[model samples]
Target chain A: MATTKTPSRLVLNGLLNENPIFRLALSMCPAVGISTTVMNGLMLGTAVLFVQVCSSCTIAAIKNYIHPRIRIPTYTLTIATWVTVIDLVLSAYAPEAYKAMGIFIKLIVAFAIITMRLEVFACKNTVAMSFWDGLGMGLGFMFGMVTLGFIRELLGMGTLLGHNVLGFRPLLFFALPLAGFFCVGFMMAIFNYVELVFNRRKKRRG
Target chain B: MARLRRITYLTLGFLLLAYLLVFSGCAGSQNRFIKKTSFRGTHSILITFAGPVDEEWATKASNYRVYEKPDPDIVLKISTIELSTNRQTVILHFEEPLNQNQPHMVTMRGIMTEGKSVGTAIVKVRKLYLGYLFSILIGAMLVQNFVFTKYLGLCVFFGTSQKRSTAVGMGVTFTIVIVASAMMSWFLYQFFLKPFHLDFLQIIVFIGLVSLSVQAVDTILRKVNPMLFKAFGVYLVLVIANCIILAVPLILADNEYNAAESLMLALGAGLGFLIALFLMSSVRERLELANVPPTYRGLPIAFVVAGLFALAFLGFSGMSIF
Candidate 1:
């Protein structure tokens, strides 16, 4: 974290290397609960993105002033404050999405990734680094959700987004909570395998 | 030293001031009529009342008016109305299938259930008695297991569940915290948040409450028994961040559950999580000897196992436990 990398690199790091769901596996509840469809995933991801970036920046700005003993509570409050803002905004502007996401939005206050970024990177790093990191991590989570959502929606319901594509449900099982577990499991394996191959190829080229 | 203390105090005071301001601003917030609404199928709406209504009044199709929430211009016609065996639940069937995604409104002349006599009210829905409470507990534990069905708390579900002993220990500790925090959350929501229309601050308040409970448990465990401390110390911290712990309170608040109902739900959720952990850990311990793929060595394989368990547990959904 202290080595001082570029913003794009940090973002990519969040997307690939430190992907919150697939890589670090910090907050898996929302990943499974909200990823029943691409739209649901995208909505939750966007909300998370806003909350993450805002909380990250706020913590980075106020890091020095917060007493260490009270830092955890302060972080929770910061995350909660951001969550409340987004929760209200969504309920007002997009009541549909708000109803769909439900308690998951409020539960975001307890999400480890937001606070993890603050305690690990934002508290020690510059505001710019925290921003990029937050953006990357948020996007990474969104990527995971959309991917899982796509797989579930496409196969589970024979639909893309909300429209029917296959015209027949191929594996309706994928739509169930049971399949959510398998989809994430397989996706993780794919990510790990690709990373392994990528590492080997780079080593050979060098 | 004085300046640092002053800054901390100032920060704390600032948060309080902001909270009070929001409270005063929303002082006009009036409590909504307590009603709970749930759709059984696309065509059926089940509305539960706190008390039994006059059978004739509640069962009359003419007594209820339904409309699709977004497009309120068109009133959907009710085909038939039936009361439950217990007389606490009213079932209405519509000519057209109700849209699950769209929120619907039901205006009844008088419930004769929730303290209203003659005024028409927009019904939301809510509960019943001992048999009902038992169903809620079982529904949460088995039929609607939070981990397998609702997909909450997968982080802790997969993390500590590597070993059977640890999983069970974590389950007990989690149940303790969840029950304790759930009661506290219920009390706070009923007394503080509901009346002031400070519902927006729920996330922050609940998180603070959860973390505080976790901290208390951590301290007490450390003092009481070193053996217990070694087992539950790590999970006690992680429990604060677990989704199930936070989810129970939100659900109770949404359902407008009473103290008894909330307690049952919290207990059910905690026990459900414990059961899930126990089952997963048992399988996971056995998986240690099995050959899992290199890429799917640890978590990936565990997830697959969880998927299978979820499938198995899903069979209970058909049971008429009540």
Candidate 2:
């Protein structure tokens, strides 16, 4: 596995191949809760990016020491500790942002995407590879969230990042949690369709 | 070897930064004098402070004053000031009943803490509405639904919502577990965690409580009704990891709702989940018969339907019965 794969491939795999939200459908709770506005999406994405990278790197470094039988609980404890640290830091330095995103931040402790990454990539890979994978997955989640937030905010509230973009909300339903399902599902289908077309074109040329 | 060493150093550095932030966070926010306030009755108010108040300085009537708007001349007399045993809460008793319609401003000046004046805090007392129970029910069930609004419990929601019967079973089990866990966590939080000031450990504690209760319910179900357990045993275990289960308790704790309100919230949230699951399962069952595109047949189409339902529920957003 190590001989054939490159770090860049690992990163790309997370971004396009196995995005946490659009592709794998993990951690949809926060994806819906925080995607009401573009700013919220970006903020939450940044927070997840920080926690995902740090936790993956740490898990990779300590993979040898963790017992296989109890690795799940250990992973949870590790994630919880990092989430608490981030929660405290945000509340201290950026109180206003923390107030808006604090509950969602704490909810990251139970996110399946982080756990899935730790188990699938971080445990077996080197620290560098795990870090890249985490970074890529984080970026992918951020991309999905920001896109969803942008469309939802633009349509639901007639704003983008609180700036008025439309005179009236076309469909306020986009801002609701139910819209998250529709957005993610439609996005996944479009992504798959695009990938299919790209692959087919490449195959024809070859 | 160099790369490994760098990784080690990076991990250690991050840990050190995290430690520093944790300690600094406690000290940095301690200077704020007032925490929050709420109404105890029509006439009285309960004020909570950031730290323990100096009983000698806080008990004096002159330190506290209540004013009405516009004129600002009516000073409601303080009949008594009672400090809680923890000294974090002070109950101010007014001589006369306050006007329910007019907003009153209560100011406590020169609040001493550790032999130093921590400045003053003025709080506006809005009239307390008594229909919080009804509003919480409507809010949780409709406005901020656990499934449709918050996107919690999706794993179980999608997993068990294929058939209507299974949906009903999972929903009932989920509601029971959620309400039970909410009550348990509320008791633990109010009596032990908050009093001891270990509120930071709430996440770990609440998760533990929820898992334990789920385990208990699992055992009871298996023994009492083996058939029902067989239907929902897998999802019952999944409840331990369900975001909604943990979220219910966490939200209740964060909002600091009283016992009745928390129960109502749990009920509303649970009912909301049940309703969403039931609706989704019924729709999916019908969708099985409808001809659709190959790619959008299953989950994608279901999502579109859920979105339409969400749009319908948006009509309830403007409803303010209270």
lDDT of each: 0.82, 0.78
Candidate 2 off by > 4 Å: A1-3, A64-70, A124-126, A154-179, A195-206, B1-135, B218-232, B318-322
Q: By TM-score, who's the top model here?
A: 1
User: Model 1 over residues B179-272: C-alpha lDDT tens digits?
Assistant: 7898899999999999999887788888889989988988877876567678768778789778899899889888887766676787788889
Q: Give DockQ: model 1.
A: 0.64
Q: State candidate 2's TM-score.
A: 0.69
Residue B60 lDDT, candidate 1, scale 0-100? 79
Candidate 2, residues B229-272, lDDT tens digits: the string is 88779888667557888788889888887676677788788879
Q: Can you give the lDDT of residue B129 in candidate 1?
A: 43
- Candidate 2: which docking quality band? acceptable
Reference-based lDDT, residue B156, model 1 = 85
